[model samples]
Target chain A: MRYEEYNLEDLFLLAKKGDGTAFEHIVRQTEKQIYNLSLSIVKSNEDAEDLTQETYLRLWRSLPDYKGESAKSYIFRIARNLSIDLIRKRNRTPGSDTVILTADGEFERDIVDHDPDIRPDEAFIRRLTIETVRECISALPPPMRELIVMRDIDGLAYHEIASILEIPEGSVKSRLFRARERLRALIIEKNIL
Target chain B: MSKHSCKKYDFMIDDYIDGLLSDDDVRKLEAHLSTCEDCRQSLRFSIALRNMTRSAALEFPVGLHERIIESVNEDKKAKNVGSKRKIFRLGAISAACMLLCLCCTAVFLMLPGNRKSESKLPPDCPMSEAATDPSAMLPSFNGSVNAPEKGEDEGYTYPVIEEPALSSPEYDENSPEDAAPTPDETCAEPEEVAPNDKNDYEYSSTDAPANPAPDVMTNNSNISDRLENAADAEKSETHPVASPEGVPSARPGGEEITLALLIVSGLLAVASFIAFLISLSSIRTHSSNKENKK
Candidate 1:
């Protein structure tokens, strides 16, 4: 049977039994989200990629002991923890706190322009390009930035984010609301709206 | 250019943008929004921000999937090698322990005390034969020799005779009949004597005079001297031989050392066996996991 057809839990169980194909499928399924989460936290594509790889490596090693929970939450939790560890280690080093704007230029170039055929008012809502949003996200505190990335960018449920971050769902909702408001203020400061 | 003035409903804007608002709350917020343009602008900015953030999804870097798989395979190979090494190490330890145990057993068997205790003497051996015929160890005489006879109330009683001084004139070293036999001659048939028997007497006809001289038999001093000499010879033979430096023949603390070695080797053998078993089980588990993967 093709491993791609298996659900996340089935893939995890097969991977725990040392099924390489199932593990690869699981990796292929989650790498994009994990990379995005890492990028949102670390603000560097290179570091984010490294963090993503390390996350999966750790997941593979720990699969034997995985208690068959939500695979997406488990994988995201690993990615989140690895990203936090990288951030902490970077904090310990001198002159490493500076945010690299490498991805901002790429984001500006890659983002599509607002379509002129649409209504002017609707186009105004699409005026905040991907680069401006990323810059605003990069400017926020780490906690708020994480909430925006997990909730808005990744579209994870409040309960799933709570499970990943090991916090209460109510805390997730409140914090997420504050994060969105904070992002809105940043967008206004950029005069993108 | 509009400043947001409706601060009370600002919190509900997020819930509204996220579509989490109830129909009643939506109606209330919509009524408030129709009269207020600032809150309307705030709601529009929140919607724009959420949309832009969702548009910011990152593409997974190319070649990362292959790298991750390679690293995992490397880790699995390293773990398999490590388990094999563990099994080999445990097996080596078990073999070494068994060898040590065998060596300890050999050494234990070679110990003087163990040898004597564990071995059985032949029935025809003098030591075995003397158990049934204790009189065979006594000197033989044609005439009635004054043998110590066992009494009902008491043990054996010998004739009370005073020992003569060696410097006395009657005691003669030159007279063949009066001369005491050498210890070697008395101890020649050591098999006939029990090591623990206190009354061991040497009785070899070849070492004794063919006929006892009349003067030697008549002399009470000579008889007492001969009996004393026999008793001294028995005592020397029964006791362990001493070294020329006066040290005892058996090693000091040899038995204790051997016993300690045996106990230690036994414990080591048991520990190594347990280690071997654990490693074997782990290897089996690892192999079974590999099989399942295949």
Candidate 2:
């Protein structure tokens, strides 16, 4: 039987009960998003992997106590918490940050030159758009950075993000809106469109 | 040429893109989008941004799942092995503790002749109950000084009155080998950690009362006189009269060592209990998982 067919709640229920296969299934399904979220926050490949391992390890240990809930939100909550902790370890400013991108600095370093007139195919445009959003999102403070990842990237519901972060639903809505607007302005300013 | 400004329905833009708008709200947004180029562009931007994010494949590195599962298994194995070996480990630790405690007590109890092992902390104030607990060295300020973390020179210290290194006869403040701390550095409430006295600054509490040396006494003669008087007064009034045979303020070296050993023992016992508690927690977690699996 394909692991994807199992309900997340059922998988979580089994995994918590020491079902190794269910735990494997849970990791397979959720590891991508958790790794990506960690990558977005810490901006390091190795650290992201470390964060992914930590997040899953904690989930494995903690699943026994988790009562019933959306596993996606629960997993992301653990991932987000670990990522935020990693950020704090580096001694950066807290909550939301405003990363002002300069041409020579961290935000723009990896961006390759692209001619606006040379039109690319739909596939290329989608790829380019995804990369541009990543560039823009990486420049945001951690709060907004992770908000966009949860709302737009992971497609989590507002209430899920709220429950995951333990913030008010209204706060999630506002932060997400602000994050998107900030991303839009960065896109326009950088001419990534 | 709509009746309302683009700004009027601007807030609804997020709702429109999110599909959170009611049909009436959608109608209003659509009407507003038709007239306002800015609003229309914004809507397109939101659509594109959302689509890109939604389409962004969460590309974790290859074999991440295997790594996670392996790590969890290893941790479980480690815990199981740890618990299984706990009794042996506990007995070994207890044996070592007993052996060490006995050896130390014997050495201290045997060394009644080595009583003159005086403290190097400047013969400023004669000893008090502070001998057993060094932070009580001076009463005005007390903080339990934990060892500084790696690369740190001083741990958390409550701002207590600091004796200037210059005031102490042995160390020359101006000497390149041991420069005295600046008055400001010593006086700064939060920032200054007296690096010179860091080892001796085991002040666990500041409740004991002692005269803060007058900061204004810059002349050596006056400073020396004041220090002597302070010492004399402290001895006559505060110190218990030492019976003729002993160095009298309770066994300084032996007492501190024994107290330290006791603290360490208490910490170890507490740590073992915590480990025992963690083992119990894991067992509960294991049982809960079993119940859930069934």
Candidate 3:
């Protein structure tokens, strides 16, 4: 059976027992989500890549002590915490912000067109390119940006986001709503339509 | 574009976008959206935002996987080396402590005060017998002039005087060239007599003859009077005398040095054993880790 078919908890248990293959499988499964979470928070490809590697290293060391119910939340929590720490350290040192870039050093050119049957204004909203959307998201306040990334970009459930953020689920919903509203306002202010 | 006047549906827009609205709420939102062009634009923006963000998930950098794996392996190797070094350091410390303890033990055993014979007194000594027998009265000296008697009502115990051995060549009986002189013939020179010497002479005066020359008696009486005055002035002070068991007389400071060394050795041995145990446990852990890797 493919390693992805194995239960995450089972994979974690095997990894705890010093199974290198199982651990690698876990890394492969969670690396994209961890990377995206890091990138969204730190906003720099290089720093995000480093944070992703660091998250895995911390996971390997702390695996034996993990008793949490969700392995996915545990991994994402590690990435989030590391990204926050890096941001705090950067804030202490003046002139530390480096140029940010996507992994391929350029934005994706082909935009996915929206269906007009659902909303009559769908084609009008599609005028805002993916790059423009990313710029708008990056311009958001850190709390709003984090909420949007975890909820919309990474597609984590509200409860999972709450668990990762150590907040109540109701707070997650309110904050996420505000983040989405802010994002929509930013896109509208861009006058792309 | 005009702002939507339907303020009541602002919160439901997100629930509707997330597919969380009930059938009834959806119908109400749809009915309101049909008349509200501004709200329809807001819904389109939310959908576009969600789509673009989801599509914007960053790709993992090429070769980062291999690098991460390599870094993990390197970290593991570094940790193993670090633990091994720690164990070696502990083992070295344990060995050094054990060596020091052995050296201290050797020095302690060689000390003069630690000799078995020197720690005890000669059995033939009268003072030793008196000291050993707690109920025994102090031995009276026949030649002690005006020896204080044991007063029944007085709680004071008289101090014991030890005679200096007359083993010098000048007093040797076997050498005719150095024949021992009679007590009267051995007149001390007035110029050579120190103030302290008078006290010694007074203590030994009881051994003298009952009838002696008037000049000698007068001189001895003068010396005895001076000695009595000095003793009275210092009556409040008591000096520590050598014990009859020869415990204090066995090489000054030797026993103390031996005891200090013994205590030091004992502490060092304990520390060394503790370090050794720590190193042994670390070794076992390291081996177990290697076994798991295998």
Candidate 4:
């Protein structure tokens, strides 16, 4: 039989005992969500990677002092802080070449290279669509960006999103719906459907 | 567009998809969705869109776990490193504040700016009566005055500069009867002060100790040199009188302004750092407090 899954309590105990493997397991599990969250905020993979790394580093460093905040809440708070810092730094030094996506999920600049004989396969198109969706999500203002991405894509509960962002649940749902409609309209405008 | 959509069902559609509505609300939404084509289609699209987005959500970059775990392990190895770095950062700010204070003090002490003008001579003022006598005053390259060696006064030159005519009418108005005596009249013979010019004699004698003899002619100095020296002495004495006024001007000048700004900023930084340390310690204590035993 396969081994039982380690819950956060078990992981917490193991991590506190200096179990690198247990901590690594936790890192592997949460890394995707934190990385994606950071990517949405910073809009750059390199910066997102740096932010994710920083968030984990802080988590491990502060783990001993952590009394009993939930894993998700702790991770998200740390990641959010790092992402916001990256966003602020990006704002100050603008004009660097930033990643841009079109409706087809292809680079807007790279679209100039016409390949008449080669057509992107379905998986490739799917990947591009996802990337384009993320790019479109990134283009929205930060307030709506995090809300829509976290609720729809990250599959966070509305209440969880509210708690993570420190907003009221009503604010989360209303804003998510409003942003969802706007995002859908944006995708439609670009003929991404 | 949803503002114009069905109120009872469309509003519930989003919550229903998230499984947030109660059973009664879900039942109402389901009943409405069966009949309302618009909301049905909207809910379907919303579900599909969410699925697509969820699939497309960012993946962990390769080696992210290894890197993060590596960093965490490194932090564990240097167990004191985190606290050490934090202390270092606090120390850095304190050191910067200290450096700023030092720099400000250096500027105040070292730079030649806005000094007490009473102690400095006017730019046009000669060092002394001997300034004209190269023999009486040896030239100094470093600008410090070297006192004359013995017998240096033997070749002293007495350059007599003409006194500037009194330009203000106050003098003439105040002394109407003491029309200046002609050069020949002044040198021809020693003359007693006419009673009308007695007040002028008293004023001049009070200011001129070298010529304090009651009769202006009785003190043996040449009339022109006496006049020039007296005028120079008056100009020199007025300087010290004006410097208290200069001190008021000095207080508002740029040197004091920079010092004030530096002092304020340094103090603010030091105070803020102290507050940070206090709060950080309190937080550490609060967080590290384990549950109280029964």
* Tens-place lDDT digits, model 2, residues A101-156: 35432342233323322323344334446777677777766667878887787778
Candidate 1 lDDT over residue span B148-232, tens digit each? 4554425333332223322233444455343322343332333222212223324344734542322324444344444445544
Best-fitting candidate, measured by DockQ?
Answer: 1
lDDT of 2 by residue, B9-62 (tens): 656887887789899989988987777666665566567777877776456688
User: What's the ranking of the predictions by DockQ, best on top?
Assistant: 1, 3, 4, 2
Model 4 interface DockQ = 0.28
Docking class of 4: acceptable
DockQ per model, Cα? 0.41, 0.26, 0.36, 0.28
Local accuracy of candidate 4 as per-residue lDDT tens digits, A74-116: 7788899888887676673322434343554323442122121
Rank order by TM-score, top first?
Answer: 1, 3, 2, 4
Tens-digit lDDT track of model 3 for A1-193: 6667898888988787667778899888778888888877888899989998999999988987988478888888999999989988887221222333245322223222222223336665757688877887877656567778888877788889989988788878876766666666666666544
TM-score for chain A in each prediction: 0.80, 0.77, 0.81, 0.73
Q: Which prediction has more favorable lDDT, 1 or 2?
A: 1
State the DockQ, from 0 to 1, for candidate 3.
0.36
Q: Tell me candidate 1's TM-score on chain B.
A: 0.53
Which candidate number maximizes TM-score? 1
Q: Judged by lDDT against the true structure, how good is candidate 4?
A: 0.59
lDDT of 3 by residue, B1-294 (tens): 233345567678878988989999999999988988867776777776778888866667999888778777777678768878876777777777777778777877777545444313245433233233322211121222334346442433232222211223343344434332223334221122222233434433454454232233344445445544433332213222325774645456755776687677678778877977877786687578768778
Per-model TM-score of chain B = 0.53, 0.30, 0.49, 0.30
TM-score of 3: 0.59
Q: Candidate 3 vs candidate 4: which has greater TM-score?
A: 3
